[model samples]
Target: MQDVADQARTSKTTAHYVLTGQDQKLRIAEETRRRVLRAATELRYRPNLMAKGLRTQVTRSIAFISDTVATEAYAGNLVYGAIAAAAEHGYLLFVCETGGDPELEASLIGDLASRHVDAYVYASLFTREVQIPAELHFERTVLLNCLAADNSSPAVIPDERQAGRDAACALLDRGHRRAIWLVGEPGEQVLAGAQRTEGIRQALSDAGTELAGTVDCKWWPEPAYEQFGAFLDDGGDPSAVICLNDRVALGVYQALKARGRSIPTDVSVVSFDDSDLAAWLQPPLSSIALPHRQMAAEAIRLLMTDGALAEHPVHVAMPVRLRESIGPPRS
Candidate 1:
């Protein structure tokens, strides 16, 4: 500190403010700020962040705690966004995964708390309602891709209902007024599934129509294949099929092919999750993409800002990636 002050011809107080990015707040002159910065650069003086953290009681670091979020391919985007945003805010980020183990999650949170982590972005691999753990320091934590059971903490999640509405509109806009079947039945326990189902119904109802039918099946490909293939065997004909997800869409595609039905030419298909498989299909699939990266970044930003938490949860917009799978209804 003394060396920097001497080089810049300024007092230790002025040098301190400038070095710590508080010069403007203290009304320090522009030229003096420049001199202090130049002196800092020349002296190769790096602030001891550990010591500073003790003095200011802020480490300028964040912890990203998750249950299998880092392991899932799409959910990993949350970690990437949090790390990138933390760096941009001049904060370090520590990532820890619990793999859905409760004991490990509690232990990791305890370890991070001891180090005085300034904030937390707690995430989940799937969008669902969850109870925030008692181990987490509530006020300093933000939930990602999940909602608090008590609705006590601020949260960020994708707008799945809007995504569903948009997905249905994709077919409707293409002049497909014929029968539209939903390929997967949403379970009551799954919040995302139920919300998407509501939106799908709303869109159709608003259009003076409704779903022609639905095939009850699990979200996985195999179950969807069996159920949809049976629907076909029973003489089910759909102008457009709205699959619950890309995985379900895969099974639907296989079943349709086995039955000698061509996509778009015979049946238009649309699904969710614009994952890699969506594009790789013979006719690239149109899908509603979950905004994982955006939601993660928003969670970090919300934690950093004061009085930003509102009663309403932040719903990040999902983007529709339209491809060749959806087209006008067959003649």
Candidate 2:
């Protein structure tokens, strides 16, 4: 207390230590220590980490950043899991949301680096090609649930490849030979979409079957609707339709209904990501739910293990969830 320090003619911090004694391992006395702790809590006192870092030359805080997908519940789960895991390692997490702007993300990263974040977790939305800013680099960094191959940063991605394969195989096993992939915009920079498509294609090849057709939604509802209508008008009659992700599938479903086609009767539909709305679709959507929490936790684990980021990136893919949306091909 200020009064105690004034009376002792010493600094408040020094006065407390003088009273408590250096290297004293004894538990706090019921009377004084508790009162001091209570007062500190009431005052919302926080230890000055910068001052401490100056003394010790190490600050135990880490920065976790996502590229503007914080609003999406699925991506939010990854951030939550990463924060939880980071806490377990006695490190602080400073989170920054970049609103999907590459420039903003780069700026935030540079700012965090200047503050000397012990490490960094760069979370990106699923895209074809993500270009991490060349100005951003760190000794300890991990990409969470997305890919940034251009930067050569170690990344942790949900088993998208497996999810793609599983979705296709499920339909194939149910006696569907002709299938179409309702994909998102095929941007050269969208690694996740491309990887998932490759997985589906590979699975189909393994099963001695091939894709019936491919549809690019261009990531818009109206455009996807138009595309689907045109495809249907052109006799795009596949026994099954596989959507790249839940949103694209929703667009496809709408297009099918517009054409007076019912799911799994006139045409079977299967998709990926098994979003929150998937099961609640007119007739539950069959999808592969990415293991967001698991992937996030693993990223933290690799980050904290011996304080060394793995030399070779570790990829872990969880299996897909099989639901009723996928059924046998229409007779």
Candidate 3:
């Protein structure tokens, strides 16, 4: 530890924290943290986490990478769960954000690996194909709240497909036949839109119903409002609408209000991701409640046990959350 500290040009305290797992800087200045990290890198000093953890057999550091931490509806709860789980096992957490960039994910993982992070956890905003770099393989790494093509490995994701179907079914139960779907833009790699939309379609098929129209709305309100507004202006008629997520739902509400339409009477609305704002919406919005905290805790648990998950994967489905948004179609 002393050698590493000298080589890294960092204080002995900082070096010890870097090696012995004792840095809890809830209020440390960012520049001071950066300086310590830079010195440690310049020294080309590698902390032997294996040796330090040989007897204890656990270094207690889990690195988490997220596609978009800021946009998540339940990000705070997810972090709380992860932190609580880690604390239970005397472990710590280091977080990184990829901002939905796959290439950057590989790079960030590589950097964390150099620190000899004990394990890894990757969280994606939506399900998609992940290009895991061979150089970034770890003894324990779990995908949280998402999945990849390589489903052989352990992953923790919400049963979004079921959630979508249930959302549709809820609307159907309220006497809605014709429905509009405001879907998210299907990117080249993101699979959430396609899978979720298929689930909604399946529900409609089972009920001998179909969508009145479809509108592709990305993760913004203005675009969703514009796209949906055009469809409404074009005389498109639907008694109910299902939004991709809470974001899209907000836009749908605005568009309807702009056109002098009332919700649950002129046009019932249902959305996924029952975010904090969902309940705050006018009359509240009916949505699917994602198991964000539960999923996060489960992922940390799996990652901490040296990747020794059972042969079968664990998939937990969150329940549907009905609010005041849906009602019978216009009489």
Best by lDDT: 1
Candidate 2: stretches off by over 4 Å:
1-22, 25-46, 100-107, 179-188
Candidate 1 Cα errors over 4 Å, as ranges: 1-46
How close to the true structure is residue 298 of candidate 2, measured as C-alpha lDDT? Answer: 88
Worst 10 residues of 3 by lDDT: 19-28
Put down candidate 3 lDDT per residue, 213-298, tens digits, no spaces: 67876767888888888888988666888888888888888988999999877888998878886898996999987787888899
Looking at model 1, report the run of 10 residues with the lowest lDDT sum: 131-140
lDDT of 1 by residue, 32-147 (tens): 99999999999998998878777887999999999997777767788999998899899999999998889998899998887888888889888888878897735488899999
lDDT of 2 by residue, 61-157 (tens): 8888877656677567787888788888888888898887778877887788777777777777563335656655645778886666664777787
C-alpha RMSD in Å of predicted model 2 compared with the true structure = 3.7
Q: Measured by C-alpha RMSD in angstroms, how accurate is candidate 1?
A: 3.5
Candidate 3, which segments miss by more than 4 Å at Cα?
Answer: 1-51, 54-57, 70-74, 98-115, 179-183, 186-189, 304-307, 310-313
Clash pairs, model 1 backbone: none
lDDT of each: 0.88, 0.72, 0.75
